[model samples]
Target: MENKTIILTGGGTAGHVSLNQAIIPELEKLGFRVEYIGSKEGIENELIRESHPEITYHAISSGKLRRYFSMKNFTDPFRVGAGLTQALNIIRKVKPAAIFSKGGFVSVPVAMAGRLAGVPVIIHESDVTPGLANKLAIPFADHIFTVFKETMGHVPKEKSTCTGSVIRSELLDGSAASGKELCHFDNNHKVLMVMGGSQGSALINEAVRENLDRLTKQFNIIHLCGKGNIDERLEGHEQYCQFEYVTHELPHLLHLTDLVVSRAGSNSIFEFLALKKPMLLIPLSKQKSRGDQILNANLFKSQGFAHVLEEEQLDAHSFLAAIEQLAAEEEQLIHAMTEAEPPKTAYEMAKLVAAHAK
Candidate 1:
């Protein structure tokens, strides 16, 4: 088969970028050459350039579209238009067969450019509540893919498909079978892993830090602190380890964790399900355009794959208490979580993109 060239756009946060990371190898296997277009300042561009340096990289200045009201919104259109111009140039130069977007503000311009160039545009929405970029780009896209069935109702059904979420290839491998062994926790330990999505959550970190002593007594924790203002001392608890990020040992860490305390980003929630690890989700506030996080948390809770707690309700004592309560029902929770197992989202989406690519 001839190698098909494609441009992948998504970024600003890990959720958007990680999907690009997950699909690259699969796209390559199917004889598709992939390039990434993202904001130079977005997390995706940095992570992609570092991890996969050889791929084509183009940076654009696409400001975010805030939900409530912000002065930046007025000027964002000009930036988006400039980004679209750059993206059009790239598309003409690369002549990609298709464009696969992960639905971030940065994706808007690139997908628009692809549409203008008559390239097939495919977008993957990783939220229960789709973002403005996805909503605006939907009409231009040839196909739209979502991580949750709940999200499909918000989009035109004719263009939408529920394909779960595309996670990095490494994360989906041996997550269950090696959970206990690789993560250095015995069956009785009730391992706990706390992550605040890609950038971490300050509120979650603060709450966890305040109750570290109580939590560490029974649960072993691997916490990704996300550059919060919380003190590193954590009351001098020996059971907790912290990092700003975790790129290398994520799969091992998730495999070993019994329960994940996380932000309700669609990627994070789906990662837990893909790993069959129950979660204690604390979604970010809707004011932060974290409405998707809230939606994701509610869905996971209703599905019985995870428990949801609002950030405002997170105090040290209450947090610890919730952990204790959930730990007691670990077996039941894990079982409920398993019902959403073996998410082949990346593979399926890759296959679709490959088949549709010019």
Candidate 2:
């Protein structure tokens, strides 16, 4: 007999996609057919649809749930309502055994609909501070998963499990080395892997661009410029590689790299930590509603695994200094990261979700 089918939702950013990337293969190994419900606007829609053409996919409308006062807030509930109806229709048609939510605004509607249908729903929150989507779905979820232990108190403890963040195999194996070589790095040079989440950070791009000559002189550079901005940032860089995205080659870059300078999104941070790479975390504190990035950076930094620099305080000089310090002390940073592991989480999470779906 075929294993029960499950519907997975959540992904507006690489962080959310990172979770799915970690567990999708495991679910397949356990004989579960996983389907996805995500927004067409998110990176997931195109990436998942193209990469896993065989899997079932349902595109749905979604809106962000703003924490600050905004006109968008007034319309989010209506969108959620509509998404719920779309999700219910998907549930009825697919009759999935369960729904797994990675907890973003994109997953809210599907989770709500799953609850109303008496279908068991599971959610995973990546940051120490739960996002608005996860918070809204908390009361309805049958099982909740988290990356950080500090997040336990924020959710219903009985339903919550601390399964460290789900990291893809490429990161686990340190395969990002080739990405560095391809980027024209010399063997003796230190490499700083710069990424600004999935959408790409204009601030980060500008900072890196401003300090490129200095950065290139000291360390090898591989920049994942967000979509459509690579050309703008790469105007005259003949020595370094610039990419809009690098899904397949990230592990190689992660391996061959000496340090990482990335946005403090849970997805990127966990992947870096799993790779045991030292990082200079630049949190997007300017974003009023989503303070999760700031909180994540602080938690990891307090533990001495990485350095946190708030976006406002970050400048070319400060960034360059931080990179120099981290590059010099990479060994200590690597050791600190290795000691922070809570557990082997993805397999356990898969087992739990599989049991429920069955």
TM-scores of all predicted structures: 0.92, 0.93
The models' CA-based lDDT, in order, is 0.79, 0.80
Clashing pairs in 1: 179-255
Query: On residues 93-116, what C-alpha lDDT tens digit does candidate 2 reach at each position?
Result: 888889999877889889988988
**Candidates in order: C-alpha RMSD to true structure:** 2.7, 2.1
> Weakest 10 consecutive residues, lDDT, candidate 2?
168-177
Q: What lDDT tens digits, residue by residue, belong to model 1 across residues 204-244?
A: 87787777777777887778877544355553345666767
- Which regions in candidate 2 have their CA more than 4 angstroms from the true location? 1-3, 174-177, 232-238, 286-289, 342-345
Worst 10 residues of 1 by lDDT: 178-187
Model 1 misplacement above 4 A: 1-3, 174-188, 228-237
